[model samples]
Target: MAETLRIALAQINPHVGDIRGNAERIRRARAEAARLGADLLVTPEFSIGGYPPEDLVLKPSFNADAAAAIEALAAETADGGPGVVLGGPWVAEGKRHNGLFVLDGGKIIARRAKHELPNYGVFDEKRVFEPGPAPGPVAFRGFRLGLMICEDWWFPTVSETLAESGAEVLISINGSPFEVGKAQLRIDLAVPRVVETGLGFVFLGQVCGQDELVFEGASFVLNPDRSLAVQMPLFEEAITLTEWTRRDGRLVCTPQKLAPIPSAEEQVYRAMMLGLRDYVNKNRFPGVVLGLSGGIDSAISAAVAADALGPDRVRAVMMPSPYTSRESLEDAAACAELLGIRYETIGIGPAMEAFGAMLAPAFGNRAPDITEENIQSRARGLTLMALSNKFGDMVLTTGNKSEMSVGYATLYGDMCGGYSVLKDIYKTLVFRLCRWRNAHVPAGSLGPAGPVMPERVITKPPSAELKPDQTDQDTLPPYEVLDAILEGLVEGERGVEALVAEGHDRATVLRVWRMLDRAEYKRRQAPPGVKIGPRAFGRDRRYPITNGYTNLIA
Candidate 1:
């Protein structure tokens, strides 16, 4: 006789180091599952201590705390309401492993370790965990259920092994972070496994933000025929109960409701919002403050701040100098008013004169150079820092990836801030995102109703406004050419010859390459920001600051 199993997939968010809080979260999910009459409650990978604890897992005390939390959760299962398939760190045979625990009747019945350790972009699992042997299915609710971790399902060996060992259904718990189009990629990767093993596939993932990573919980279930049965929403915590019944010796899940998948623009915007919101809230900051230049980059940064933390929580300061145009001041003021946030204007003329006089004693009467331009930027930076200190607000840097890529930004000047909102975005994308934000305000945004950013801000040429007639194109190549060259070099795909062959001027490409290589030290010192692309600065792309090897041809 065949049976039915109601497995509740909990897509939840867990902090990196909060073991006790994570356990509480697990308990809450279990209680909800009990009410839903679920036979089993499945959670994301590392639900006890959070994912990518980084070096925290190496600490003896942290692992001990994680172990204690798991035991406590196991003891709660005595109520006999719903069995739990939990993921956390486990120490066995004198080595640490990414382990999953199966709890039933007030005790941990079995522990399954992950077989594959991923070592690539954004994943350093091999450094912390020792791989376990290929695992078979664990008996749960009168059925042999194959329990696998995040990376195990990415490959074929683990699923194949479990199928050969008499598993009825495949359930994978994941802490997978959001990339541009990762949801479709996950479905594509799972379809083959489901077709080969003739097993129902359940991918239960976490929904949360951790440092530079944001996990969008678009969990889903697929029938053995490679058809989607259940689909959960992304970028949020959701509890989805899926039904499965054995039919003709093959497990098939009952098709349920499917949440609408977010568009590319929506997903990228939400990732930035969630990442910034968590970074500010988890660290316990009152609010955020930023310099509101009339340029496109600062405009977008201010919009994101207002969206993440409510309008009243954001403060915009317009620091204009003698070189600043009247249109810039008006544009900045309009943006602030439109966003319904606090705004103020302070002239940097006094600070500039003071700095110039103080440095005049050295008899530096030479023609004005880039040093003077840097002084204005430093003055604005000092002013922002002072305001941040007085108000207990974090200062948000407004520079984007295009500027950061080419050493175009001043060190300790525009770069002085607690966090950056557009650090990974390029200049070309900056304009596009501003248009997107104006056309549609995101779901949880606290910004204004109509266009928060003035139309002129998006249409005007971008500039630092440190000197008169200083457009970005005057100092560098056009944004279109620059961004294309950057994507090629940063993605590690095209070299100098390849770029030149792709209809790019050899001189322009080589100049951009040299600037990118020389600016590594500056990016190293810049503040952290949300990552919305395939490769970001911090963890995704790591280059030595003092490297002398140049890929550019003479």
Candidate 2:
């Protein structure tokens, strides 16, 4: 039996539906692993077709292409280098499955399908993939590897069965998405399995943005004694070779240098940067253009854009209306200068006037209220859209979760954009992220190292600037109160009476709940944004547009 083995954990990013391209990425990683004298290369789940290909895997042509690509990669193993264990969609025994294949010596040596198909929140694997039977360890060169797909490692049955069946090591290939506090949760879940099975664990994951989802690749390894053997950095692609040896008749991994974990704020900021960067680059957008209002939402959004795509690719426009404050104009200019992004001022005064004159004939006796305010917002939206159309830059909307939750934004108005960076961030967290960005430029940031916004921009009361003397508090509750209530309503999914019991005003809680329900239509029309939290809108949290069941208790 071999006394020592070197396994390379490849943390890579794969584009969905790009079979040939993803196969090339795997080949590159395998080449690097061979150079490092590794015996085996383990990649993330669905590395051949990317994670959560949605309905794309259902097509027979795509599956055939993926199968062919996997076979081609397997043939490359004949070069007497490292073998590969990779994930892809497979159809066998008249059923479709999320399969993990072992490629060795120019052919597929073994195949294992995922037993657990995640169905909750952001995953619908059960709908597309049929669960395979409980898996056993796959025999490699003098080693038995307990292979688990992404969701299979979450439960105890698979690991327990593998250990009982004489598996020497546990390896889980994952395409898990990122959410706040998820890294620690991964460790928390992993340690228990190690304790139960008493085997070293290897977790390899992908790092990329797939539409509304962002996968932070913080792949890691746990020793048989439940100690961390290797820690890969988050939000970046890396390949680390872990050496294993038989100690006391069991496999044990040698300790490697651990990468420092970023602060929570930094993690979220990096996730935003990576998410925006991958979305723009992957979707082939030339660049991004967003309204750089002096408000915190737009300011932070612009900062993220500049950091993500570099200053030259990001464009900031100030579309000031009559209600826009002079302070806002100056602050926007200062922020644009700080970030070194392209800035231009296109006044929406003409558009507003034209719309008013055109609608004046139809409304003779009615006085102006929110209707006029909405027109101003729509005018600004129209201005931004025109710029996007002319320059082919994608519009980056700047609405936060608090505003989006209660319908504070207008649908074809302030919400006009191809994507949003702050859609999942609450108003309270928006202020915190701005302050954090001012203090530190994240590691791979392309923007300035210093502060990205003026101090007053963070301190000032937020406003849409649709009317004179308007603040967000004019229509909604204070952000402190509103965000707290929203966390209970949206994240916690608590009832109105439960919030009232927690010392929130009964009337205020009821009002927030009603508004949240009424705004479903608007949210359904909003642009896709980076998902930072567990219950992000769109894919994570799905609610019926027309619902009669209200969780209102007396």
Candidate 3:
């Protein structure tokens, strides 16, 4: 008997609703696996319709399309004799199932519905999918294989079931989203599964950025001894084979070390870079452009673009106005210099003044206020849009989740980009990233030593630099306080009373809660960024923008 079992872990990126395209990708991956002489190929969960198709899976015709697509995938495998485990949505007897269609010898020989449908933290699978009764072990080329879906990995029962069912190895499909330390978490979780099941466990996770979520492709296999046998890259797509050995009927997974953790900024930096790269590349864009405010957000965005798509393809435009600070100018200049990007300084001062002059007559009695400040932003937006119009570069917006959740951003001003890069990051995480960059540099990073951001940018009072001496603290609580409350209210699902119980001030907590509730409309209009936390305020944590909601204690 041969000791080696060659299996390809395909970290494929699938676009939603593009069934034909996704099927084609599966076919291509299968062909590549055959070329490499792999015995089996495993793809990510819901690769056919992409992850979290939401209500789309509820459609009967869509599931039919998915079934047809799986037939095509099964037929391809019949020719090369390589078994495949592909994920898609299935409909049977008016119940929808998140199914894994196993194909060998060009036919759907075995199938399994995902047993666990997660209901919390970015998953609403229970609403759409009915639980499967039980699926027997899928036998392929003399091996009894167990199949597990995305959330089933979080539990030991699924693995125990497979072990009890005489499964020799466990192969799981996942659409797991990226977050800090999540790569390590995946491996850590898999260890117990392997040890208890007494079988080699392989994880195949989706890659690429979809809407607000970015899937970090750190696929790996763990031996029955609970040791990491093989590991893949963190943020790039690659299909590689991990060969397992069988000696004296004992399955042995080859030893492989995990990839080193990049700096905090480097981790976030690569995430955005890959997110932008995949979003642009998969969507078929030539390049990207963004407003460079010299602030931490845009500066980091431009730097990411330069690394993802070379400097030649990236354009950074600084749309400055009368209120734009000199420090902003210097920092923007220094950032562009550091990144080696194509920098342009387009003064919006003239346009801003003209717009103010045009509106001065109607605003005679009213003092210049937030409306006037926003006018400056809209003016800069117009200029950037004009430039984007001239050259067909996609504009990337830079706004953190904290500001987006609280209406701290201006529409048609800083919001004038095709995609938002830091939409999931809070202001506190933003500072953490800045410090992370100073400590550890990523591959091809062009930022400076000490800090890519200026000292004033970090330690000085936080401001939008929209108006003179206007600091963020003047209008809102500190980033530390605000982010904590948000995490409790949003992620931890803690109510206002609970927050107060947790030691937050009653008035302050209510004020922050109002800001978050009021800003729902703003978030609805904001561009999507990579989701790094449980509640990203976009597709993950959805609330009605016009609701009159209050959880404040008297």
Candidate 4:
């Protein structure tokens, strides 16, 4: 008969570069696991030094501090608590490597390095850490347990090697970031490994927002038969204990409570909220303020800011210029009232006139064109920045992906902000997210209930309101068509002709492709925002601003 083994999974949020602080967190979790009578505790990959430390791993001091923190945790385990399987940076054989530290009996019994270093997409692990050889199972408490870091379990080789080395169960830790529909992909990818090895699999993940990445801790356990035994919640830190018992010469994990995963809309909304909240809080911003233009983009951005940092912390400024309509003013006011945030009506007409007068001398009788329109936008930006400076709040920009892709935004004007809430969100998704928020206020939302967004905002034609009777369609295609074309180009990286062959107009595709190519410089200067898609502008899609590549011309 095999004795029952209790394992505690710690889904914790680790701050990057906070070695001692992360060690403190591990200590607290270890104490809780000991109180729960668990035999072992597992943490996510890069738990101590945080995930994707990037170039920080190059510093000798950072690595030294990380090693010291590991030693501290190992010494603390001397008091007879649960054994810890933690992850951090390790230096071995004159090369820095991402490693898993197996600590028991006041010492690191075994050290396993990450066998696979993912280099595609947002990961650049190959540049920083050296990959270790294929790791075999580590013997622990009368069981041969295989410990696999993130990217290791994604392939069949690691699990096969472990099973061949007499491993009974697989424990995989991850610092997996949240993208749209990423949760399902994790399960889909892990299930095949379980089927191939005929071994129970336990997935432990870290939960928190780091820069543009959000680590959703949807941890789970799958038995050898491919049945889900335990599930941890997403977008939260948790410690779940699962009991494994031997039945009929096979180790079986007992079923535990499962948390309901949020809908696609809810997941994206929460990811934005979490990403914004952490960015503001971690960077020590007093709060956030944005221009409330009563359009869907600004309205939803205001709502997200209110929900992220309570309404009191959010501030809205309505900067109405000469071209600003009465409906926009009414809807902007209504939106502010619904969210219960500080709202101010600052007419940008005065600033616009001042700028017009100042630039009149250089105009040399030239007729008013985009220069005048951009002045209105710059006026609003200047006002928002002034308010941000006075009130000590960060400015939140509210441009959607559709506008961003086609170079429809004013660079130094509307793009002036500390952060962007809807940077990666498409215009179509913006409408959907706004409707979802109105219908269902997310859990832990700080704004008032029942349709925080005014209905008129969504139904109205989207506009910058920089000129009289102007709408986005005056210069761009319908959002439905525009978003689809942009997605095919941006996400799929399809050629202009490919998009045209997909039933889109060749002229429209060529025009959009030209705009997208020309907007690289603007995007390069734009603020960082939450990334919900795989091919977000910054980090993920790195196109040179000076490049002359053009799919349309080709």
* Candidate 2 error regions (>4 Å): none
| TM-score against native, each model | 0.97, 0.99, 0.89, 0.97
Candidate 4: misplaced stretches above 4 Å? 247-250
CA deviation > 4 Å runs, candidate 3: 1-4, 55-66, 79-81, 92-95, 126-128, 246-250, 261-264, 438-460, 495-507
lDDT of 3 at 85: 88
For each candidate, the alpha-carbon lDDT, in order, equals: 0.89, 0.93, 0.80, 0.89
What digit string (tens of lDDT, one per residue) describes model 3 on residues 213-237?
Answer: 7898888888887877788877767
Assess candidate 3 and give its TM-score to the true structure: 0.89
Worst 10 residues of 3 by lDDT: 444-453
lDDT of 4 by residue, 215-298 (tens): 888999999899999888988888988999866544679997788889999999988888899889878898999999989999
The better-scoring model by lDDT among 3 and 4 is: 4
Write the residue-wise lDDT of candidate 2 on 1-554 in tens digits.
89898999999999999999999999999999999999999999999999989999889999999999999999999988999999999999779999999999999999999999999999999889999988999999999999999999999999999999999999999999999878778988999999999998888889999888999988999999999989999998999999999987668999999998898899899999999999999999999999988889999999999999999999999999888999999999999999999999999899888988999999898999899998888888888898899999999999999999999999899999899989999999999999999999998899999999999999998888888999989899999999999999999998988899999998999999999999999999999999999899998889999999964863
List, residue by residue over 127-245, the lDDT tens digit for candidate 1: 99999999999988688999899999999999999999999999999988888899989999999999789998999999887888888889999999899999999887888888888
Which candidate tops lDDT? 2
Better of 1 and 2 by TM-score: 2
- Between which residue pairs do clashes occur in model 2? none
What does the lDDT read for residue 40 in candidate 4?
Answer: 94
